[model samples]
Target: MISIATALLCTLVIRSVVSVRGDEECDASAAYSSSGGKICASERGDGYGSHDVIRGEDRMIPIWWNYDIDQLFEDHFDCGQIIYGYDDGHPDDDHDDDYVDGLDDQAVKEQHIKISDPVSETELEKLRYQWEILREKYVREVNIVPIFHEVKLDSATETTGVDGKGGFVDRPRTHGVSAIVVPTRIGDAGPTKGRGVFATAPITKGALVINLDNGSTGLFKVGHSWREFAVSLPREVACNFIEWSWVQTVPPSSVIDEDIRNGLSIFIAFDESNLMNSADWDDVEANVRCGFPPKHEGDDWGPCRFHYHATRDIAAGEELLLNYGDFEEISQQGWVDIGL
Candidate 1:
């Protein structure tokens, strides 16, 4: 059941009008109206689940794990603040600014920016600054190895194959940011397969498109483990985890650490950063490319995050695509890349 605080949080959340809710039964409002069945169909090509289902269709983003509602409210960490607060940190701070001249701080909370305004630029800047400190405090392993994504089961034959379920990393600390509602995003687009992430503005090169820290309770970046992972989960929840939008498989021939070689399927759960799409090697050559920001100059690096930079210049209304593992390389190696 949704808590009173959670319900209040939703009233302040920001939302993209064109979020990738499919046409049939995937409406976000419907999520609130009904308990889940196998009604909402899947939209990806990765053959894992026959279809995906959202238990609360009204919930804006898919959550792989639950959050502590009481603590979130006690700390004044409203999930709605995530959606309603500063996104890309670009709204004006001046009271004379026409866009938000009249709306008091209390009134500036909505999924759409119509009646709302973001937190002050100072607050947003401070949040970004705090993120820098966290990255330095917890320097762990870089996790994009080619072996962790080892569990692959043939759905048609119902056959499971894995020499051993690979490494499973303990959940990381939460980042400061948890609100998924942002205005810097465009409506969803699908070129070859499922939905992809796009920019609402002309994104500059080396721009930090997204960041995930361990402290943000809404997001969880975990390693896949078949033996101890989601074994007893219901089909809808389990399969959705398997076809993780954030799970990127590093090529086999690419030499890397011995420990991280576990078919690198970094399982992450959250809203925007995790929901972006994957482009093949050539689909976005003239546009944005993904990179891992080194932990310096006030930037943190992690296995799950691959920041997208404009190869040349990405125009507004362009889809932001990350180059995923080469299918041929994974196929040639004869190892199926599974999320969990």
Candidate 2:
């Protein structure tokens, strides 16, 4: 059930276009409505299931997760299911030995290869090769699919002190900001102890902020046992674009604070860690010094830079910020050190 407070928070944050039940024109000035039909100037809900109403399909935006090369292998094979190769009656098919013992040993080795430790690069490449073959064989049998959800805007206007309408008027080309409304701190917020939103302009009350690319939906499971997903940007260039757009939109008053300006810097930091961790470096370099090191100077760095939205306008007392860069790191570091 959605609380009245949550509903009001949503209305004030997103600056949704007010729709009269049967009216064609949206009334921007009309009092915000609740699920119960009560017209109130302030944000309120009946504490029923209105939370869903305030944050439902109308507000949901779609994002995609392009499977990483390794993820593709784990998804199809390591999920407790066999995805490749089949049993051949002749056990010594690939070896010169044709005896029963040799054939049995080959079968055992093949089973180990199928259900052993983490998939190796060679194994992943082989899987990809096999997948391609299977894909061709069952092009019509395979289905392309998408996961959908009604995620709340990560940077809501109330949270950022921006009016929704003002954002549209000022930055027509950019989407507004939204806040991460998760029950618990996740991503960079969990580790850094602080969280914020991203935008191209000063966000306005009632405007919508799309959690595009690395914003929120970038989460993915590592393995069956691990529930937390690392924070990451789709590409390094996309990170620069988000950072650049934010830096371009700041007001002179807020730009002088180094801490605020650098706050967005953590986005890059978390992304870097995500990139490293995703490669499964720990196991690969178990015995070699050439692999990723245990610790580095950049590891403990904090995000102190602040970047403003290009054309968005903000009000006073908003939490002024960006999304947490990575969740695993944030959860490990605790929330306090993230912003400072």
Candidate 3:
């Protein structure tokens, strides 16, 4: 086991490798923010507030944003497969042949995977401290997650964004409409002016409502940071990450940024998730829930995912109202840098 003294020493040394912020493409793990040259500074109020280490087995990470990836793909094609981050192995390494975790045909092969328990409370706290102070500089940015739907399209909607071919297009493009929730503006119905997410039909409780893909609908098992484009990101990206998101912390990704402890926040830069209104806790319209499959889930292990599920039987016309805590407005008391 690593000694505590050695670990503390390592933390300072890791932080010393900060990269000067610039408009150039960021390495994600090595890039630091401007001003004090930290990943994010609450004192400077970079819009990313409170590096408070709130720990949980599946704690929410309001960290970075990931969008504007169309340029990465050589061509825009049908990512026909269910959107998910492949683990260290084949894309389907996390599930068996009968089913690709929960994706019916998405898994590439069948295999047995070991099961691991969720991070224990004690272990979580220990990790929280180590990652926060000693973590490498990088913000796991989650700008958009594609919404994969099973229900049929009720309207004349078809795939938008890229040519529906292959490869990537860019941010703000669409894979199509999600069968899970529909975006319909409910003007001043209650306390919101944004579009409300409603059910396409009667959705069963406990159903897998979302898959959490960054360019698609919601963010998946990726850790991001505001590196290359912090100062130049689109306004939509700003609203999703810093303005209307519940940032969650990322555990050490052994496969990706093992040395970097990043936080992740997910929401569409331009979708209904950015507009889902808040409701009372006892009478929630929907719940922004996420889960991680066991070790058996391998590549499918969602370190963190943004999934909105129905808390109760919701009617078709009823707007999806999530309990955004005691006062959704109170969370933004110190919104001096919310530029979006």
Candidate 4:
């Protein structure tokens, strides 16, 4: 197993993949580029090879976005044969013969996958997360961003205290104690902008909001198929890990061994600190900054600890933002001189 500590030593390099919807490329300079990065379907073709399945007039939605597992599975049943990849070890075998093939309405189901009775909500969420990871990998390999339906804003209005005079707003719920989530105007324009970190109470300048020390469990997992590893874990374990982890689809060139470059890494931050969003360094609203704990004379081997602090005094409801400046440079230089 590649140690997360060793992986961290390899600086991060981020590669930009141009997003195209149909024939034209997404305009990076457009006003809506940063606003959730969505593009419209072109009248010519939607480009997913299944153009016949989806009309040009309809909004392009990723195949995995649907929540109904049975329907979703039926729609992309062929993917199951590819993803599951069941084989009986025949060198010259053509496995496609095992299943009946025809149009969706005409094909007869020949294979069955069993599901547990009374599927729990957590299990369903895990399935969704796993499905998303699989589809994301597929799309990246093909170099296209699947157009997704706009996420619906939370339907419930912000709750208020008994005073009824803009008394209170429900804070973002979390299992840890670093920061709380609050609504902010940082995303696509809709009924709600998006969720961001907020101070549950007053915080003084330079105060630490959260501390991350991943020496114990190395913050990264390097592999070719992280999805298989994730899904193979016990139900609850896989669910929690996937819910909190972020996948770096393309790894830095510093770690660019032929095999490693093709593979990806999964980063896990074992705290709510992972929720902190990015902002520009000069942005007045960028209140949070990441720092490292001071090294003592004898603590030469202490694991890298990431400390997040307030740049200025922050009010109870003010959003916390960090400037995630050139991560590739930071990773390329290694964490020893991370100035952010």
* TM-score versus the correct structure, for each prediction: 0.34, 0.18, 0.34, 0.32
Greater-TM-score candidate between 1 and 2: 1
| Weakest 10 consecutive residues of candidate 2 by summed lDDT | 222-231
Judged by lDDT relative to the true structure, which candidate is superior, 2 or 3? 3
C-alpha lDDT (0 to 100) for residue 101 of candidate 2: 45
Candidate 2's TM-score: 0.18
lDDT of 1 by residue, 232-255 (tens): 223222333323323445334335
Strongest candidate by lDDT: 4
lDDT of 2 at 279: 14
Q: How accurate is candidate 4 locally (lDDT)?
A: 0.35
Candidate 2 local lDDT, 73-190, one digit each (tens) = 2321121122111114332122222333454577765654543222333333332232222222222221121112122344343222112221211111222122222111112222
Total backbone collisions for each predicted model: 23, 58, 34, 2
Off by over 4 Å in 2: 1-116, 119-262, 266-340
Q: Which prediction has more favorable TM-score, 2 or 3?
A: 3
lDDT of 1 at 298: 67
